[model samples]
Target: MPHHLIRKLEHFTKLSCDDRQVLGAVASKRRTFAEHSDIIEEGNDPSHVNLILEGWACRYKQLDDGRRQIISFFVPGDLCDTHIYILREMDHSIAALTPVKVAEISRASLDRLMDEHSRVTKALWWDSLVGVAIQREWTVNLGQRTAIERLGHLFCELFLRLRGVGLTEGDSCALPLTQMELADALGLSNVHINRTLQELRRAGLIVLKGGCLTIPDLAALQKASLFNPNYLHLDREGRNLDANEPASD
Candidate 1:
């Protein structure tokens, strides 16, 4: 299996060989979940943090009437919620969108790893910072972007995230989300979501078929979506960690 966490961390800082081995060892004891199954339910006490190894999942909350709002999507190399053990119970639920594999790291083990590895600890902190940045971007996306721009921004974000974990090929990637799932994430009705996708397709911006998305012109799509990748914090070095304008490709 790919050392996705290591690869993700290396983007911020290089890890020594020993650090890589330690991360791999700590991420053992993998398990799988079926599609639509809750990995961690709301109000449940979480004793372990999960690292995604395969497939996709989402953090979501349900309304009294059973309407769901997806808070965020989790792809390979994502930490479901680090340090969640500090809380008495989960505030939201994490459910698998596809057949998913995850490695559960116990609180004790995580604490030990942090204590023993300064560089690894710093890398994890950087990872947490990026998570916060993404949440802020999502808030902006919901509050400001139009339906078409909202969906387009989402596609760009996913493409980059998947590319970070080596899940993308060239300009295309597997986008296994259904229209209903997209609607929930974007806070739009299914009809609106479908219409927005059609608009993007008709504009010669994207090719989404068979659960895959291909952006023919990434720069054009970025402009159409009004997307700025500054929130992603993907700089090779830790300098300029704060959000800024998107970097030139």
Candidate 2:
């Protein structure tokens, strides 16, 4: 079932029983990929929207020198390329960060959902807008924030985002990326990312071990990073709708 997706969309609006059922149907069929495998490559025609059902994936651009810049991380419940069908080809590639399972939502299926389900359509719009907002914040992260601040901000954002989708456990969440991958995402050297991680650990703001990240004090970390959640637009804008499902992680 696409419980995670339902949980995520309900954060925006109340979903009816029918809405949940249809969404589940769309995500019922899934495909799995091994770690490091490419789910979608640059220049591929955008036919289906991939929904992460398990594990992690990233959308990235590769330079001629073979260096990569990870643009965004996709977790369960995330809809990859919701509006990218309008594009003739994908501008970047999406690869699995871990063994991943995704639901390939065909354009025809998506069109039917949007045409019939008003609430789902609205929530999808919110999802797309939030994606752009996150990209903008990432730009600021790479351009202005110091190394330590960048790492902290990214941690806080991921924790909150995972929590919103019911993937977090208390103050900790799964963080499967390696230090090198973190370096690529933040536009820093591997050594810089290592040093920054050490700094965060020393400050008692984070605990990273065994592929898990524990933020003992999220508020303090957010303060140190100057992180703000406004760009996420997670304030439950469609609170008026009737949501029948549970959203607790």
Candidate 3:
């Protein structure tokens, strides 16, 4: 094992080398999922918790009537099953939105980490709470924001999250999202998404070309989304953006 997973954890919390190795002991590379692959079937017992090492995925719930609603999307360094432990059976299905690399951390591994270091366990649990808060924020956005605001908030989220993983630079990044995907995330029609994107461009906030985001004004963009870091629970041993971003260069 490359033990690269520990690198992500090293920044978020204060783990001793031994503790780091212990956690790494349980982490192993998972099978890669192709774009649109069904990762976990709804109503199935989740067998293991997975940490995203690469790419994007979405969790969604479907109704008997055939309507589907996306609940959350996982980015790099986000736990694919951080909340799945409490799930006796998955209520929703997860799908890879792009080629995705995951790391499987078995339940036994999680139990061992929790037993060895309570702080590590607490930090991981806090991640789940933050996940809930994000879903709540999305609900508020969908209920109140205009299509433009909704889209802006989604963009803000992408920038911040990618920043968290040290993947952003000078207000620009490779953002491979289609208009239809944006529409699904924002609960709007594709036409509405296209119109809002144009409005964002007109405002000198953002531009999309060649599947890349050119954010001319990151500060203004964050303001538009009411983006807040408090919900992210920055106390983890690793994945600390502030502690990592400035040093990334």
Best by TM-score: 2
- Give the worst 10-residue stretch by lDDT in candidate 1: 240-249
Candidate 3 per-residue lDDT over residues 1-249, each given as its tens digit:
313334434445545556656666766657789998877889889978878778888888878997667778887777875647667898789888899888887877787778877656765666667778888889988899888778888788777667665778878876877787777777888898888899889998898899889888888987776766566555553544444333210
lDDT of 1 by residue, 62-161 (tens): 9999999999999999998788999999999999999999999999889998999888888899899999999999998899999999999999999998
Sorted on lDDT, highest at the top, how do the candidates line up? 2, 1, 3
- On TM-score, who's better, 2 or 3? 2
Q: CA shift at 183, candidate 1, in angstroms?
A: 0.4
Candidate 2: segments with Cα more than 4 A from true spot? 238-249
Off by over 4 Å in 1: 238-249
- By descending TM-score, how would the candidates be arranged? 2, 1, 3
Clashes of 1: 0
| lDDT by candidate, in order shown | 0.89, 0.91, 0.73
Clashes of each: 0, 0, 8
Which is the winner by lDDT between candidate 1 and candidate 2? 2
> What number of backbone clashes does candidate 3 have, counting pairs of residues 3 or more apart or in separate chains?
8
Deviation in Å, model 1, residue 3 alpha carbon? 1.2
lDDT of 2 by residue, 1-249 (tens): 788888888778877778888998877678999999999999999889999999999999999999999999999999997877788999999999999999988888899999999889988998999999999999999999999999999999999999998899999999999999999999999999999999999999999999999999999999999999999888875555444554321
Candidate 1 — which pairs collide?
none
